[model samples]
Target: MNRPLCIAHLYPDLLNLYADKGNILTLKRRLEWRGLEAQVTLVTSSEEARPGDYDLVLLGGGSDREQEIVSRTLRRSRDEWKAAVEDGLPLLAVCGGYQLLGEYYQLPDGTKVPGLELLDMVTVAGSPRLIGNVAIESDECGTIVGFENHGGRTTHHHAPLGKVISGHGNNGTDGHEGVRYKNVFGTYIHGPLLPKNPALADFILQTALDYAGIDVKLEPLDDELEKAARTAFQVRRMNLSEVAAQTP
Candidate 1:
């Protein structure tokens, strides 16, 4: 793609907890390092753009109330958004985003907020919020790291959204993690997953490249910088694990 890559950041109003916006910065920098210019565009309920305008779409984690707020707009533009995904557009949705993609999110008062149902899953509200860091090992992918913080538990009505390598996902129900289908990878992992796990980051970038039919070399970062990055990642993982172990 000759033009600078555009990323559609959906529901920034409610889906940016944990400063997940940092992930976008990490992605942008990584892409620029690989010689692909990147641009991030925000899309709220009031602002809707054509699917073809972006190379990637992102939905971050947010509060239940915020999720409901964003849902209003999502419900209105869901068809166009779904069409974009059907066309193989790249998407990365976090906790709130992940829940919104399911059939529906069961609220506390027996009320239900309808979801896009883009994936075969349902998020049911739970008590004693699930929070903490997680560790995951993907045979097809690799080691994955991130934190999970949510009160809703997701159940895979059909196939499991994804496998769990580490951490308490989907409310410790074994399906605690988010769903990943096609070029879309939805998870509860917070910001810094990209900076910590460069391999996964490259995987995402490669997915976009593959979709665009672009072949590019995966330039390796300097050994010193790579080690420092991994060390920081490990430290975070260990700390979270320790905290979770002591939570009870």
Candidate 2:
């Protein structure tokens, strides 16, 4: 595995709300830190690339307007994209990117943003948005922490990444937080999503390595700072729901 892993970062310019591009940096740096090489290519509507053409793909959060633009871009490569995902391409989609993987995300005023339909799910705008720190319990990754802020209420038909340990998940009603299908993952978690959760990041890299036919178990890296961040995170990270539940 001397060759660099090709990473396609989709819509960095438009879908970069809340420093979403940080996830891309997190992935690339993690690979390098492990003595592995990774090459990232920015893919936008103008630079649409086949999802299967890369070792990994990352779609970050964005606004509704940006989602519409990306939808059209993806529509051009729809079949190819669908084939790639079905073929087990390791993809991580966050926030608006997560919604893009579903059937459709219906807006408050009745405008439905078209999605890639890769996942059997739908997001409809709710009255108040789901926001604040998120804690999910995953059997594979243990307790994962991040921030989520969205108005969409998603109904998932796919297996959930984990149960909600804190904060609002896919929908406040459901105890789940993200979607897991084949090698593809969709989540509303963002705090740039990977820096605090190294296990999940490495899980994606390992899956990508496996998908790319690279025979290697990922070497573990020290996550002391990441752990410390989580420890400190409990101090100020607030969730309205948690506050309400604890009220006497």
lDDT of each: 0.74, 0.88
Model 2, range 6-95, lDDT digits (tens) per residue? 888998888888677788888889988988888899987678677767989998889899999998888788888899999999999999
Off by over 4 Å in 1: 157-162, 223-229, 232-248
For model 1, how does the per-residue alpha-carbon lDDT over 1-248 read when each residue is reduced to its tens digit?
Answer: 46666777886766788676877887888888778877789886678656778778778888888888877777776788788788898888888887888889999887788888777878888898877767666544576776677888887654333467666776686643666676677777775456666777777776776666566656875446755866786787778678878997
Backbone clashes per model, in order?
3, 0
Residue pairs with backbone overlap in model 1: 135-166, 169-176, 170-176
Q: Which has the greatest TM-score?
A: 2
> 237 in model 1: Cα distance from truth in Å?
4.9
For candidate 2, the 10 contiguous residues with the lowest summed lDDT are 233-242
lDDT of 1: 0.74
How far does residue 128 in candidate 2 sit from its true spot (Å)? 0.5
